[model samples]
Target chain A: MAELTYIEAINSALREELARDRGVYVIGEDVALGGPFGATKGLAAEFGERRVVNTPISEGAIMGLATGAAAMGLRPVIEVMFVDFITLAMDQLVNHAAKLHYMSGGQLGIPLTVRVQQGAAGNGGAQHSQSLEAWFIHVPGLKVVMPSNPADAKGLLTAAIRDDSPVICIEHRALYWTRGEVPDGEHTIPIGRAALRRPGKDVTLVATSRMVEVALEVAGTLANEGIEVEVIDPRSLLPLDLDTITASLRKTGRLVIAHEAVEGAGFGAELLAQVQEAAFDYLDAPIARVGAPFAPVPASPVLEQAFVPGAERLAGAVRKVVLGA
Target chain B: MTSELNQQEAMELLRTMLLIRRFEEGLIQTQKSGISIGHFHVYIGQECTGAAAIALLEPQDKIATTHRNHGHLLARGADPRRLYAEILGKAAGYNKGKGGTLHATVAGLGFLSTSALVGGAVPLAVGAGFAAKQLGERCVSVGFFGDGVLEEGVFFESLNMASLWKLPVVFMCENNSAGALGQSAGEYPGSTIATKQLIDVVAPFGVPASAVDGGDPRAVRDVTQQALARARNGGGPTFIEARTVRWPGSRPLWPELSTGETDVAFAWEPDRIPMAHRDWFANDGLIRYVRQLFDAKLANTKEILALDATVRADLAKAMRFAIEAPYPDPASALDDVFA
Candidate 1:
């Protein structure tokens, strides 16, 4: 294992996948030039211009192309640059790529992975900073995965490239520079399995994407306070690791879910509803959820940080669920 | 020489055209009889375009077509029994009733996706070409869409990328609109494109473009052959716009059998042809094909009638099979959501 930043881990995943499979290819607007965040840097040189393709700035068409290529047994990984711009390719991703397998009577397998980054930390304004993982999670045909750290950023993406179904791997912009040790080679984490970040007895905490790191921090602090908080990172959202989560809830008897997206009608709501159905009897206290407000992400760093849900809000929710305070 | 046809080729083309024409008409009749297929588009007037263009394609070549996709599939010899079953939403359908009339993809036959949304599958053809090129295969891919597809930005993007990357794909635009662009009597509703000529749209991308009389099977076949050759030779993508007058039976909304089930006798019986839909019959590609066969003596009127009878008989059995085909098990609806 080596210490690699989230962005470097992702780049490694692409390089490994491209090298591992002749059918695998990378396509996006600036993918030939390593894309906007440099996750695909030097890939074009390594894989040749054919495999690491740079496409025109037409998200709809580019997405359609990837979907078609995937249908023909080609594994295409597309970088949407930002999750916000994915709206332009919604038809291809949702209708074509997602539904093609079922619609074609199981004849086609869309082994396509769409990689997008979401977070409110960039102060890139409302258009660029919104965490839109909920929209993809709601889609029936798509497998949604969020990697909170460098290790998962590599593993989940590798699995997504190899999986038969279309997967949307939601990376966090803020986590790109965050460093963590990733396994050296051929590391693939199973999708739909939750990673246990910390084991505790007082309250169970489920966090997604960047919130996992935040939850770990809060759990660490709360541990010092003698209130043990369990942290579970649900790597995959669609095929949710409800089994691991309910087991955690069964042990702890209190739960709190956290994400960077808005609290209203977000992934938290879905997870909360599912958690209740599975572990309603086990819960000793009402579940708490910490998330951004309903407003669009602000451009100013002060307003953006204030608007985004962070450690303070998570700590309050954790304390509420664990201490009844 | 462009219109030259061998006896077997002419007979096969005529049979394919008749099968497509009869299948669509049979579907309309079924819908009218309260079977309720739900807002399906037909390749009524432009049968020749599909039959001719697709006939040139090898088994390895991929097809991604639009809403008017029945003809393209039928042209490639897709069983009418299964196709009918698919349209009727039955278990024996091409997609096992999952994809109905709108998205009838036959993956086994190299069809990628039959998208109902306009221009949705246009870029898919290019992607198939990209796959072929990357895999070092000499295969070609084809996209069959309508004139309205030109209005979509994806079409332009597809053309630009296909040209830039030298992807081997044929973009076949079936422009059924009559007169200039659109908005004339008996004209098919089409895109209000800024370019006077559809071929001119591709000039900026530097992809070669051509126009063929869609009614003429020979012309459609010839143009498609040229385009396919250009693509396979790594000469890049070729765009062909097949133009046809909107069939009179093809109405403003729901199509009608206004022409009363295309009589092959119209080929010889000029006086028997109705004057009201005269232009439709006169320009009818299938009918013109029959007339050309008679002139060339590829198949006499007697032989042609016999072929039509056989096609109808086959279709009759296919239709019955579709009608009798059961709906898939309700529990299976949850299946194939992934993979």
Candidate 2:
């Protein structure tokens, strides 16, 4: 095993999948030219232009191409430059790819993977900064994945490439440089299984994306105050591991969900609802949620910080829900 | 090359056009009966467009279309019953009742898929064409849309990309004079960029194009056959504009549609439909002589409807299954989202 950054792990997994399957290929704007984030650097040099295609600046065309290719028995890994721009291709993702198999009486299989970078980190601002995973999670027949760590990112992405459906794997711009030990050789992670990073009995803290880091930080701080909080990173939001979350809630009788998206209808709220519906009898307090306010993520660093949930706000929510203060 | 299609083939083509026309009329009546609910745009006068286009396609070729899709869906061999069930919102419908009237899909028949959004299906068809090219398959992806959708940027971008890559696709524009609310006058800058201008726009892209009379199946078939044969033989994309008129009042119009007082023959009504629609429907001198054509088409349609009954019953069974089917275990609502 070697320590790799989230971006490196994702690129490595993409490379491995491409090498492993002849049917697999990558397409997007600047994907052949090393991409906007350079995640696809040196890929075009190795795979040639046909495999690592550089397309015109048309998001809809790229996604629609991926869907059509998937329908035609090709495994296409499409990279949307920024998650914000994915809105422009929403028709392809929602109307075509996601609904193809179900609509085609199971005669068609859409083995397509869409990689997108989302969320606020370096003031990419209102347009560039968005956690639109919740939007895809709302649709049926789509797999919505956002990994909080390098290994999970690589593993989940590899799994997404092989899955026989449309999978949206979101990479955070903030998590790209964060390093972890990803399996050196070929590895695949099962989607829908939430990882229990730190187990405890006092309260269950569920988080996703960059917010998972905040929950882990808050777990440590709360531990010093004699509060044992379990931090659960829901690697995939759509096909969520409800059984594990419900079990955690059953053990702790308390739940605090967090994410970088707005509180109104973020994945956190969806997680909370699942736990509440399944383990409502075990609840000792109202579920606490830490999320950004419902507004366009601001451009200013300070305002962006205030707009999204951080370790401080997350810790406070845990304290309030756990210590009853 | 004219010998490629025999007398039987020609009759089959005419029969298919009649089926599409009758099926569309059925959908309109189904909508009228309140069984199907939604804003439906039926191709009442454009049956030849679908018949002729599909006649040019092979089994491996794929197709995509816009919201006004009942005719194309049926023309591509989709069962009228499951399609009817799809419109009925029954569980056993084509898309398991998920995609209603606007979004119908049949992968087995090579229809690939359809979408409700304008200009939505164009890029997908381009992508399918790209896939066909990549696989070294002798196939073409055909996309059908109205003149109103031509204004969309995705359509232009698709045209540019397909040519840039030399992908095999036929961009069939059914310029039926009027779109849902906009008239051809309001939709276009002027007749300067008429169907011929559309062909000219794609000429420089190295993609050969032409505009044909959409109401006449022979014209549509002749133009599409030349285009599809060229595409399969590795010639790049081709854009064909089928210049047809949607029977007036078939769809609601905006900025006020011309009243029927001046042109009663051009008006669309329930009883004054189908067989008599050509001469009686239009201001033509061949009104008395059209009886033979109408009688022949009527006999063929009656036979086709009889064959359609079994499929309709099967679809009805599927509909019963969907309606009586148990709802998702409220908990399973979140089941498929992640996995």
Candidate 3:
């Protein structure tokens, strides 16, 4: 194991994948320069320009090129800089990449992994700070993953690169610098499994991505208040580990789902529906949700702080569900 | 630079063009007879561009084409039986009834994929070329698009990156002065600037660009050869705009939706050309190619007629196979969504 930040873990995963497979390469805007953040820094120096390709500021072309390269027997890891900009490449990602294997009658496979950082941080306004995991999880052919810490980040990225399907890895911008212990070499987490960070009996706090960190903090505070909270991080959103969440809900008899995206139509809603269906009668209270309000992320520090959900917001939701408010 | 073709190569080119023409004709006839459903775009008048450009591609090379892709697929040696089955939405089709006329792909034949969206395939070709470069392969990738594709932002982005990386790709624009949904090129806004010549738009990218007579298969073949050679030799991409006419008979799926006029029309009778307007079928690529074959004594009329008969018979057998093929099982619809 090695102590690394979330960004360092991602960089390590890229380096290991690049060294592991000849077909694996990285391509995206400013990727050679380590992208806007430093998640891809120093990769080009080690791999050379041919493998660590830097593309123009064209999301559509970047996505289309990656899709084609994947279909033509290459494993391409594409970075979109930010999650919001993925909208520009939706045609290629949603229409072409997602549908190629199905549309081609299983004659082709697109082993593509698109990496994009989301979550509001550093006053990065509406455009750059939005969380769009729900948009990708809704697509049928896509595999959506969000890692809460440096460990899962490395493991999930490795798994995504090895999978023979199109996987979208959503990394939270705020968590890039957060340090944690990650397995050193060839560590891979299965795409559809959930990780239980804490065990509790009163309520279950099901979270994703950055919100998982918030839930962990909230769980600690709740425990001091004598409200034992279970924290479950669903690493992969599409093939959700609903079984684990349901099992936790059965034990806790209450649920509070949390995410950084908007409350309405977010991944929280999908989890709410699934948990209710699986363990409907186990509820000790109406399920609570912690998410940003239905407004765009603002640029001002105060508004941005208020816009993003934090440990206090999640703790409040947990208190509401646990105390049956 | 002109790439000389032996008589056998020239004959093969003629055969490919004729085969595409006949294949499209067969599809039209099948559609008319109510055997096929859904919309299809035929490469009727612009056969030479696809046939000739694809002829220059090596087996390992790849090509991504637009919705009007039957010609490119056939020219690249995709099986007619499978293509016909796909158009008919049969389980035996290339895409197992999932991709019909608008999205058929035979990956084994080096025809990577086809896109119903205009200019969608351009960036894909760049990706394929990038893969080739990374793998140290000498394969060159080609993207066949229409004149309307120039307006798409992705096309320009593709060109910029391809040139910037010196990727081995050839952007072949089959300019027929028309867009999708049967809109005239002149009718679209900024048509004057975009449609005048493609070289002007690509010149800013510092890539070699040229315009050629798309009607003559040999001319297209020579130009395509030069571009492919440059790409294979690590020279940057080349943009070739082949000027041609959209076949008058290439009507929309719904005849009523057609604008009652074609952007370019050809005269069926050669003798009437003198009195006809210069734009009235100024150059029929198919006829021109056939004339070259006869004039050069590469094939006599009897031989040419026999070749046409063979193509027709083969298409007839393909249609029979397609008609007899089974429909996909409803339960299988969910398969192949992911590998």
Candidate 4:
């Protein structure tokens, strides 16, 4: 095992996938220049220009081109710079890529992976900072994955590249520099499995992407107070591991869903509905959702800090469920 | 810039065009009888463009076409019975009834997909060409779209990338508005593009562009050959605007069989043609191709009539088979979503 940053793990995964499969190729804007956030660092030079291609600032064309290539027996891993910009390519992603295999009656298999970043990191403004994982998880054909750390990042990306379906790998920019222990060789995590950050028995705290960090921090603080908290990081949102969350709910009897997206009509709502449906009698208290307010991410750093839900907001929600304060 | 199509190949081209024409004629009739449901488009007026151009493609080459995709599919030798059943949403269809008329695609026949959305196939062809280049294959990819494709921003984006990357692709834009007073006949039902000439839109990209009479099979065949040759040689993409006169049948909001099934004899005996749709027959590319065949002594009236008769009989069988085909199992609707 080695300690690598989240971005380094992602870059390592791309390098390994390219080296492993001759059919695998990378295409995106500035991807040859190692991408906007260095997720593709040192990949273009390592794989050469043919395998790592750079396209113009055309999201729709990029998505459509990747879809076509994937259907034609090439495993294309495309980068869209940011999740917010994916709105431009939604037709190709939602209408074409998400529907091609089904529409073609199993004649076409799109083994495509789209890598994009989100979160209110560096006060990047509303256009770049918003988390849009909620939009993709709703798509049927797509498998949505959000890695919380370095190990999951490398493992999940490798799985996505090898999968037969089109997968969307959404990374949080704030966690790129965070250091974590990642396995040395050939690490792969299943698409729908949930990872338990901390095993406990009082409250089941569920989080996604960067919000997993907040859940862990709040759970650690609560641990010192003799309050046992179970932290569950649902790595893959689309093929959700509801059984794990429900199993934890059977013990904890309380649940709190946390994410960087808006609290209203976000992935939290979907999770809340499913959790209640599966384990309605397991609840000792009403579920609490910790997320940003229903508004665009602000430009100012201070406003952005207030806009994004952090450890304190999650801690408050945890305290409400446990301490009843 | 030459096509060495032998007499046999020439007859095969005519047979494919006839099949496309008869299949569409049957579809129009079926729609009229309120049997075939939903909104569907046809390739009645621009048969020569699809048949001649696709005739030049090898079996290994890839194609990305748009909504009016029946002709392209048939030209690639798609079985009419399955294609007919696909249009009728039957289990024996090409796409297992999942994709009806608009999205019917033959994956094994190099047509892995045909987008229902306008201009969606251009970028797909770019990717297909990219894959071919990566594999070091000499096969060229073709994007068959309408003139309305030029209105989409992705069309420009796709062309720019194909030229910059030297990707082997042919952007075949069928402009069936030669007599529509410059008004496009599809999507918005008018030419709303700001560019005066559609070919001029891709001029700044430095790629070679051509404008040919979409009616002339040999002329369309020659231009398509030139573009395909350039692509196969790694010379990059070529945009060919094949212009044909829009048939009166496609003029209204809903397609009507205004010109009727097609009369091959009108090419030889123009005086006997009906006056109401005379302009349509005069501008019809299929009729012009037949006259070219007659003038060159490549085929006689008896031979052409025999070919049409065979196509009609086959189409009649295919249509009956499709009409009697079963609808897909409702439980299998969720299948193929992942694979």
**lDDT (Cα, tens digit) per residue for candidate 4, span A142-201:** 999999999999999999999999999999999999999999988999999999999999
TM-score of each: 0.97, 0.86, 0.93, 0.96
Name model 1 segments beyond 4 Å from true: B1-3, B178-189, B251-253
Give the DockQ (2 decimals) of all models: 0.80, 0.37, 0.81, 0.83
Docking class of 4: high
Positional deviation of A145 in candidate 2, in angstroms? 0.7
Q: Which residue window of length 10 is worst by lDDT in model 4 chain B? A: B178-187
lDDT for every model?
Answer: 0.89, 0.76, 0.85, 0.89
Worst 10 residues of 2 chain B by lDDT: B253-262
Selected candidate, larger TM-score, 1 vs 2: 1
Candidate ranking under TM-score, highest first, comes to 1, 4, 3, 2
Every model: iRMSD: 0.9, 2.8, 0.8, 0.8
- lDDT tens readout by residue for model 1, B202-298: 9889999998899988788788889998998999999999998777666644666888888899998977888887877888888888898888878
Off by over 4 Å in 2: B1-5, B30-39, B89-100, B182-197, B200-206, B253-280, B283-339
* Residue A186 error, candidate 4, Å: 0.9
